[model samples]
Target: MFDMFKNNPISSIACVLPPALVNAFAKQNFYSPEQVRHVFTNELKTEHNIEYALAMFCSQLDFDALQLAVTYKELRANVAKECFGGWPRFNFDSLLDYSRQSAGAGGGFAGDGGCGDGACGGGGE
Candidate 1:
């Protein structure tokens, strides 16, 4: 994915930003890189903190071939709850709710519910 943005510096940095940060900018209708940077800086409160939310956000790349990453660990808990037998002894009720809301807001369902194509069908099992 970085290779795809090698020629486009803005896109390269854009790809590096977490989806949450990207959503924050979009939600505020931020139109400039400086504005986005400002919000990120202030919300996080740091001069050059590598621990910015986006930095933590991009740590989990879903697929090696894709730039999209799933940084929401709650989503994983939800998956484990709904399909893999309810998260053992953990309290996933709220996690399930947030995951559902997030998935809904992001559009469509997840997991083996026969939503579409081969997706969420559990890998031909």
Candidate 2:
């Protein structure tokens, strides 16, 4: 989105994936356009402009909590190496907590750790 912090500041905020990147990313990852939209718009809810895509899907929307978290951790450690430089303390669990607290159970993720399988622990807890 930026080049050594010298690019257009406002435009740089946009996460624009080139056609080639979109095609390549699609081949490997499976997510809906809605999910991608939230990843970009989550800034209004959280201070950060962008979020761990998979984690946002899991924590802020209805998706597999455990599976998405595992994938987020892996991506945060592996594929998202560049992001680690700016984000020193990345924690999926904490992000989940924040998402839940901010949006309430209606936020949408499957549920927090307190809930049983297939149950939505959401804001009730």
Candidate 3:
């Protein structure tokens, strides 16, 4: 999955987003697209946040925000299904907390020997 994401054209948007946000999404366990979308949209709601960052970056690169958003939505859905197995609802806040704790402990991201269940390595948690 990480390889697919890396090779995907839409994955370039990850460069515009904060590394922490990208890492959190990729490393953490999100049971459903709706759950991840809720957290993602909320994370972008702040001024000069994800949406603003994407818009500014995309504008300079002549990328389309609407199309990128659509593609990003698809990416999130795929991540939820492939990495999380579309399991039962999980707490988004808890996932964020776990991410923080893991990072603080020098665990890095999931693929880097973090506490995650190897989801980012292309297997479900």
Candidate 4:
């Protein structure tokens, strides 16, 4: 599955994402880079949607929300550079913000605790 993403625009982003998140996206019919980009850039149009999707992903994958949030933050620049040509023009921030809020409220992501794993590196705020 990882090998399949290597040939696309989201290669860098996909490489670092939790396998569950990648699989969740795949299950949602987001197989192509363009479709995935559309989800990041367009499909999630509101704070509610962002929060809902975050919660859904966490629930579905039993993944740590905080870890996912940290991963998202860590991959922001790569997503922008590799997929959007240095353009950070997307609603991904809303998703990040909502994820942070959800994590804070729930005390953590579903499975793990937080971003201390070091899997997430500095990318953007």
Candidate 5:
């Protein structure tokens, strides 16, 4: 690939790629270098933040190539969720407001589900 990219437009593109993207271009257990490079180049072109996400996903890769989960897509999703689960992109205050609205509206159903006779339906426990 270095020989092929020496004087090519893709060389400039490859130079700016992150290391995670660079490593994905190499041959893996059953695939050839050209095959790996072509596939990952296309994915890198299409997917946002794919190099970082794939780095998170590839930490689980084994030199032994042990098969655990089935697909790269599933593994990628799981890794991405673990990495970005608390990104804080939503308006959680709306959920808090909703909970408060339910607090006094339904016979104490907002918590504990009391019988209202103060028995708690637990043999007076």
Candidate 6:
């Protein structure tokens, strides 16, 4: 949108928008069409301009709670490494500790951890 205004500043749609709002967004320095498309699609949830789709689907046809826990642990570790620059202070074990404490303190998982097997007892073992 900034490029849209570079040629004719006064007649641009950007100019018609509230100046403060326009200025605030401009600081992000988004020059690529991909960046603009992602921001717009997230805000609108229609993905009109994006060409690619990113999705992760896990179907529990045969897996149990222990298997699901392993998947969650791997995903959390990978995200922390790739997106957060490194592992966070809390890892899978720590997360399990927190969850168990939460459950012990009156947080039940839909009356039995949502698994046929009773609520899991802490860590991702």
Deviating ranges (above 4 Å) for candidate 6? 1-70, 90-125
What ranges in model 4 sit over 4 Å off? 1-4, 9-64, 68-70, 92-125
**So what's the TM-score on candidate 5?**
0.19
Model 3 Cα lDDT, one tens digit per residue, 1-125: 33422342222222212334445555432223333344445543432223323332222223342455444434344433332334223234433443444335523333222323322222222
Give the range of the ten consecutive residues with the poorest summed lDDT in model 2.
9-18
User: Global lDDT of each model?
Assistant: 0.32, 0.32, 0.33, 0.34, 0.30, 0.28
RMSD of each: 16.5, 15.1, 11.7, 16.0, 22.6, 21.1
Q: What is the TM-score ranking, best to worst?
A: 3, 4, 2, 1, 6, 5
List runs of model 2 lying over 4 Å from the truth.
1-14, 17-33, 37-52, 56-63, 66-70, 86-125
Between the candidate structures 2 and 6, which one is better when assessed by TM-score? 2
73-109: candidate 5 lDDT, tens digit per residue? 4543432232223221212222222223323331222
What 10-residue stretch in candidate 4 is worst by lDDT? Answer: 106-115
Model 1 segments more than 4 A misplaced: 1-31, 49-125
CA error at residue 27 for candidate 4, angstroms: 15
lDDT of 1 by residue, 15-46 (tens): 23334344555532222434445554544344
> Could you tell me which 10 consecutive residues in candidate 5 have the lowest summed lDDT?
116-125
Error of 1 at 105 (Å): 13
Candidate 6 per-residue lDDT over residues 20-107, each given as its tens digit: 2223354222223334344434433554312211101111222223233245345434433322234444332332333344335522
Better structure of 1 and 6 per lDDT:
1
Tens digit of per-residue lDDT, candidate 2, span 10-49: 1112122212224333422334545444534443243232
